[model samples]
Target: MHESPITGNGDVVKARQAVRVLAQEARLSLVDQTKLVTAASELARNTLSYGGGGTMRASIVTRGTSTGVKVVFSDQGPGIPDLDLALTDGWSSGRGMGLGLSGARRLADEFTLDSAPGKGTTVSVLKWAR
Candidate 1:
């Protein structure tokens, strides 16, 4: 499967379009498409809000025994000083309920976060076909 990279405003319509393209090409079910796209939205928002602008790298890959759609978000923001606290629901820095990453984690089948105080942040989420 091929991959597409998106950046900038992380517009809702564009993000969903990217997801639809993958799901269509991969022959993923409608249910999976909805969840995956929702997860994408969360990732995109974080990029826009905290990172002051970030990049969204998406691809379909086969890893080991699992094949799925993966979206990676990276940003050069102030960096999350408190990952633990940041992930908490309703615990936001300023204009968030603090549920972005946490919600994304719950929706995705596989989630990983890499962040530091000043070095920036990277997040990856994969949703495998069921």
Candidate 2:
């Protein structure tokens, strides 16, 4: 298993690179690759745009003797006051199409978000090799 935690503006780019590499190595479908990449990109942007910039971690997970890609994005910003609202389409705290979380959710095979007001936000996603 490999672990990486991204921090700062440039870290997001690195996170994207990591995602691309994992997607390629995992031999995921082109459609799944596109979705995963786009999800990572959007999540990375959210970390920068919302959080004071955050962290992204990637690792190879072997569970039940199966291979998978696991990524986690976290931020220590204002934090999401209403997770339900944040996850809704066309709902945003900024000038976005409100698709960040929603879109990311649509792309990932597994997605989870943990957030609280004044605490911060963390999002995790996983894609499997099929």
Candidate 3:
């Protein structure tokens, strides 16, 4: 796994680029690569803006005969108190359109979210190669 710090805007860009590279290396199609990169970008931005900075881990994953790229974004900031509402479309806790989490989920093959009120948040996304 490769870990990139999401301390600022530059770090978010770095994280997205890293994910793109990993997706490419995984032999994902061009369209899949774009989707993963876009999802990574959204999550990275959320990590910086909402989570108050965090780390993004990118790696290749395999299950059964399938291979894919996985990215995990984790932060130690105020956790989402209403995950259900947060996942709803057109919801925004900040100035954004609030499409980050839900949009990322739509783009990935698998998505998982973990957060607690006083703890933090972790979002994992995986896109299988096709």
Best by lDDT: 3
lDDT of 1 by residue, 40-130 (tens): 8877778777877666777887768766788888888888988888788887775556778999888888999999988888988888876
Model 2: residues with Cα > 4 Å off, grouped in runs: 1-9
Candidate 1 segments exceeding 4 Å error: 1-10
Task: Give each prediction's root-mean-square deviation over alpha carbons.
Answer: 2.2, 1.9, 0.6
Cα lDDT of model 1 overall?
0.77
User: What overall lDDT, based on C-alpha atoms, would model 3 receive against the true structure?
Assistant: 0.93
User: What is the lDDT, from 0 to 100, of the residue 20 in candidate 1?
Assistant: 66
Q: Residue 130 in model 1: shift from native, Å?
A: 1.3
Error of 1 at 54 (Å): 1.1
Q: What are the Cα lDDT values of the candidates?
A: 0.77, 0.81, 0.93
Best by TM-score: 3
Q: Estimate each model's TM-score.
A: 0.86, 0.88, 0.98
lDDT by residue for model 2 over 47-71, one digit each (tens)? 8888777778877666786666777
Estimate the TM-score for candidate 3: 0.98
What's the candidate order when arranged by decreasing TM-score? 3, 2, 1
Which stretches in model 3 have alpha-carbon errors above 4 Å? none
> Residue 120 in model 3: shift from native, Å?
0.3
